[model samples]
Target: MILLKLFWSFFQIGMFSIGGGMAAMPLIQNQVVNLHHWLTLTEFTDLITIAEMTPGPIAINSATFVGIRIAGIPGAIVATIGCIFPSCVIVSLLAWIYFKFKELTVVQGILSGLRPTIVALIASAGLSIFILAVWGEDGFSTNPLTINLVSVLLFTVAIFILRKWKPNPIYVMLGSGIIGGAIYLLI
Candidate 1:
């Protein structure tokens, strides 16, 4: 029953979450943290961090991590399949439809309109993550005592490095991780 539930939950995530993995973050949090109570908000946020730092889509990485935590290898397989199944079907259908209607003004207009919505979804996800990193699961508070200054500092430095150097992201991530680890050891 748990396995089935895991499969169904991820299948729904894959089906409804448009605009790629970042857009799916909120839905994944809702399902795993709010609905299922499989993980706390903090845990979900941590999982998102791990997922972002790993390979593959964030949704798939999240599904696999949760599934393994819940029910080991079999659960991971079922969850991964569930997460990818909808995308497989949807992409296939859309490919055919897109080719068939490639020249239609209505189709082009619809596609154009989706751009803003997708951007909004991605932005919302990024904001959620930033909030989580800065304030944890408790969310923002009027008192500055609860804010994570280390996270904020790291975030600012990362942005500065990106804007200033324009180096490959792999180096930035590695440097951040090393800096974060050093800070962790110091404090």
Candidate 2:
């Protein structure tokens, strides 16, 4: 029963997450963190960090990780499949329709409308993660010290590096990891 619930949860994520894996983060968070209570917001944030570092789409990686946590290897496999199944079906249908109606103005307009919605979804997901990372457990932390100043500083530095040098993300991630580790050890 838990396996079925896990599969269904991811299936909903896959079906509605129209933009991309990052866009799916909000839905995934809602299900895993809000509805299911399988993982704490902090753990979900950590999972996002780890998912970004690993290969594959964030949605698939997260599904596998959450599934494994809940029900082991079989859960992971089922969750991965659930996350992908909707995209597989939707993309195939869309491809066929797109080729057939590639010249239609309605289709063009629909695609244009979708672009902004996708951006909104991705932005919303980013904002939620940002809040979680900065504030820890409580959204409104009374103690200023509880706020993760290091994370905010690292985020700022990462943005600066990206804007200035445009280095590969892998280097930024590695640098951040080392810096974060060093800071933690020192403190």
Candidate 3:
């Protein structure tokens, strides 16, 4: 029954998450954090970080992580399969339909319309993460004492480094990890 629930949960995520991994964050958060109570909000944010650092799509990584946490290896396999199955079917069908209707203005218009929606989804996910990182669990407090100085500093420095040097993202991640670790340990 747990396995069935896991599969159904991820299947819904895969089916509706049209834009990609970033756009899927809210849906994944809803299923795993809000609906199933598999992980807390902080854990969900950590999951997103881990998922981004790893090799595959965020949705698949999230499914596997939540499944293993809840029901071990078998849960991971079932959840992963569930997450992938919809994308496999949808992409295949869409590919055929797209090629057949490649010349239609309606198809072009539909594709154009989706661009803004996808951007909005990605922005919403990014803003949620930023708020969580800077403001703790209480969320969006205007009190100065409630803010995490370390997180704000790290975020600012990261943006500066990225904008100024445009170094490899791996280096930025590594540097941030090392700095964050050192600061947290000292504090």
Model 3, 48-98: lDDT tens digits are 988898998888998999889999999999999999999999999999999
What is the C-alpha lDDT profile of model 2 across 1-187, one tens digit per residue? 9999999999999999999889999999999999999999989998898888889999999999999999999999999999999999999999999999999999999999999999999999899888777887788577888889998999999999999999998999899889999999999
- Per-residue lDDT tens digits for candidate 1, residues 21-128, read 998998898899999999998898889879989999999999999999888999999999999999999999999999999999999999899889888888987888
lDDT of each: 0.91, 0.93, 0.93
Which ten contiguous residues of candidate 1 have the minimum total lDDT? Answer: 134-143
Q: Which pairs of residues clash in candidate 2, taking residues 3 or more apart in a chain or in different chains?
A: none
Q: Runs in model 2 with CA error above 4 Å? A: 140-144
Clashes of each: 0, 0, 0
Give the number of the best model, judged by TM-score: 3
Task: Give the C-alpha miss distance for residue 2 in model 3, angstroms.
Answer: 1.0
TM-score of each model, paired residue for residue? 0.94, 0.95, 0.98
Considering summed lDDT, which 10 consecutive residues are worst modelled in model 2?
Answer: 133-142
